[model samples]
Target: MKKNPQQTIPFNWPHMTGKELFYIAEAHFNGRLAGDGPFTKRCHAWLEERTGCSKALLTHSCTAALEMAALLLDIQPGDEVIMPSYTFVSTANAFVLRGGVPVFVDIREDTLNLDERLIEAAITPRTRAIAPVHYAGVACEMDAIMAIAHRHELKVVEDAAQGVMSTYKGRALGSIGHFGAYSFHETKNVISGEGGALLVNDPASAARAEVIREKGTDRSRFFRGEVDKYTWQEVGSSFLPGELIAAFLWAQFEEADRVTRQRLVSWERYHALLEPFERNGVLRRPIVPEGCVHNGHMYYILLSKDFDRQHLLDEFKRNDISSVFHYVPLHSSPAGLRYGRTHGGALDVTDTQSAALVRLPLWVGLTHAQQDRVVEVVGSLTR
Candidate 1:
C-alpha cells in the first residue's frame, strides 16, 4: 500500500484564543451591535497606544480605511499618486476610485518595498501623494521617503496593511506617515474576521477622517456629546465596522505583545534555518532594515531564479505544503495597464523580484515540526 501524504497545512489561518467569545458575548449583552460601541472604543484606544498614533479609527477593512484616506486627501480627477508596482490592487484602487492616477514605480530587491530612490523620478507636476507599502511587515526607507515628500510638499500615505505595532527607527510604521492604513483581516497577524483601522498621525487630519469614517456625518462628535444631534456634513461612505468585530479584535489586541513575540520567534527560526541557503546563493531570505522591529507578519524566500521558484512551489504542493507566489507587478496587470501609468521607467527589478519570490506557510499556530518539514523540502529542491 502507498504511504499517505502529510496533512495539508494552510498558508495562513487566524489563531484565536477563547477570549474572543467572551468579548462577543459582552457585545451581545450590551445591545450596541452597530459601530462605535464600547468595544470599538477599547479597540481604538489599544491601537492608538500601540502605534503611538494621535487617533485611530476602526473600519470595515484596510481597503475601506485606504478609500477613506484618499477621500480625506481630496484626490481629484487626473491627480497622480505614486506607489509601488509590486503591491495588492487595493493599494492603487483606493486612489484610482477617486479619479486619481496611480503612478507605478519599481521596488527595491532587498525589502521588496517601493524604492525611495526611484520615487523622486516618478513624481510629476500632477503627483499629489506618495503611498508607500511596508511589504511583508518590513519597513521601507521611510526617512528617505519622508524627506523627499517634505521637499516636494507631497502627502505621504502609508499602506501599512501588513504592519501593526511594527517599528522603524523606534517609531511605529503607521505613525510615520501623514495617513496610515492597517488590516485585521483573517490573513493578517491579528484578525477580527474582516476589520481594519486608519491611523491619522497629523492632528489636522484626524477630525476630517472621523467625519469621513462615519458616513459624512458628525456622528462621532455627536456621540462624544460635542453636539446635540448628528447630521451629514461631507462626501463619505459607511466605513465603520460593527461592534462584534471590534470586540473580537479587542481580544487580540489585549494580547498583542505575546502574539507578536510568538510570531517573531518563528520568523527568526526560519531565518536561521534558511541562512545557509542564502549564503550558498540558492535562495535569499527577508532583510529587515537596520532599526526596524517587525511583527513577523510573513516569511518569504526569493529563489536564485524564476524557474527555481516555480519548481519549489510545485514541490511544496506535492509534499502537502502550501507555499505560494505573490503579486504580479501592477504595471503588467490588465487593470493596471488600463488605469495606471508605469512612469515609463524600467521595471526589471520589480518583474524579476515578483517572479522569483515565494511565500512559505506562516501563521501563528504553525508548529516547529511543520516548519522543519517545509525547510527540508525547500532545501531538497534547491540542492
Candidate 2:
C-alpha cells in the first residue's frame, strides 16, 4: 500500500488563542457596535504599551493609517514622498491618493529596506517625507534614515506592516519615526480579519490625528466629554476600525509574548537547518542587522543565482507544501510606472532580490513535524 501524503501546510493563517470568542461575546454584550468602544480602547492601550508610542489609533487597515499620515503631513499636489521600490502598492498608494508624487528608491541587498545612503540624493525642494518599509519584520537603519530626514526637514512615516513589536537598537520600529503604521491583517503575525494602527509620535499632532481618524469630526473629544458636541473641522476620511475587529485583536494581544516566542522557535529551527545550504552557496538565509530584535514574522531564503525561485515554488506545490514569493518591485508595477518616478538609479539589487526570494510557511500553530516536511521538500528541489 502507498504511504499517505502529509496534510497541506499553509503559508500563514490566523492563530486564535481560544480567547477571541470571549472578547467577541463581551463586545456583543456591551452593546457598543461602532468604532469608539471599550474593546477599541483596550486594543489602543495594548498597542500603545507594546510600541511605546504616545498614542495608538486603530484603523480599518494599514492603508488607512498611511493615508492618515499623508494627510497629517500636508502632502499636496507636486509634493514628493520618497519610498522603497520593493514594497506593497499601499505604501505608495496612500501618498499618491493625496495628489503627491512617490519617488521610488532602491533597497539595500541585505535588509531589503530603503537604502539610507541613497536617500539624500533623492531629496529635492519638493520632497515632503521619506516612507521606509520594515520588510520581513527586520528594522531598517532608522538612526541613519532619521538623521537624513532631520537635516532635510522631511517627515518619516514607517510602513511597518510586517513589523509589530519589532525593535531597532532598543527603540520600537514604529516609535522611531514621526509616524508609523502597523497591520493586523490575517497574513500578519496578529490578526483581526483586517485591522491596523497609526502611531503618532509628535505630541502636537495627536488631537488632529484623533479628528482625522473620526472622519474629520471632533467626535473622539465629544465622546470623551471634553466637548458637548462633535462637528467636522478639517479635511479627513473615515479611518477608524469597527469595535468587533478590535475585540478580536485584543485577544491576540493577551497572548502577545507567547505567540512571539512560538514563532521565534520555528524561525530559529529553519535558520539552523538551512545554515549549511547558505554556507555552501545553495541558498541565503535572512540577515538581521545588529541591535535588532525581530518579531519572527517571516523566514525567507535566497536561492542560488543559477536556480529559478519560481521553479522551486512549483515544486513545493507539487509536493503538497506551500511557499510563496513577495513584492514585485513597485517601480515595475503598472501603477508605479505610470504615476511614480524612479529617481534614475541602478535598481540591480532590488530587481534580482525580488525574483530570488521565497518565504516559507510561518504561523503560530505550525508544528515541528510539518516544518520538517517543508524543509525536506525544499531541500530535494534544490538538490
Q: State residue 304's C-alpha deviation in candidate 1, in Å.
A: 0.5
Off by over 4 Å in 1: 1-6
Indicate the residue-level lDDT of 270 in model 1.
Answer: 96
* Alpha-carbon lDDT of model 2: 0.90
CA-lDDT, candidates in order: 0.90, 0.90
TM-score of candidate 2 relative to the true fold? 0.97
RMSD of 1: 2.5
Candidate 2 Cα deviation (angstroms), residue 49:
1.7
lDDT of 2 by residue, 1-383 (tens): 53223467878767898989888888899887789789889988888887888889999999999999999998999899999999999999999998999999988989999999999999999999999999999999999999999998899999999999789999888999999999999988888889999999998999999998888999988978999999999998899887888889999988878888999999999999888788778888999989989999999998888787878888888977779999999899899888899985668889989989999999987888988888887787556
Ten residues in sequence with the least summed lDDT for candidate 2: 1-10
- Candidates in order, TM-scores: namely 0.97, 0.97
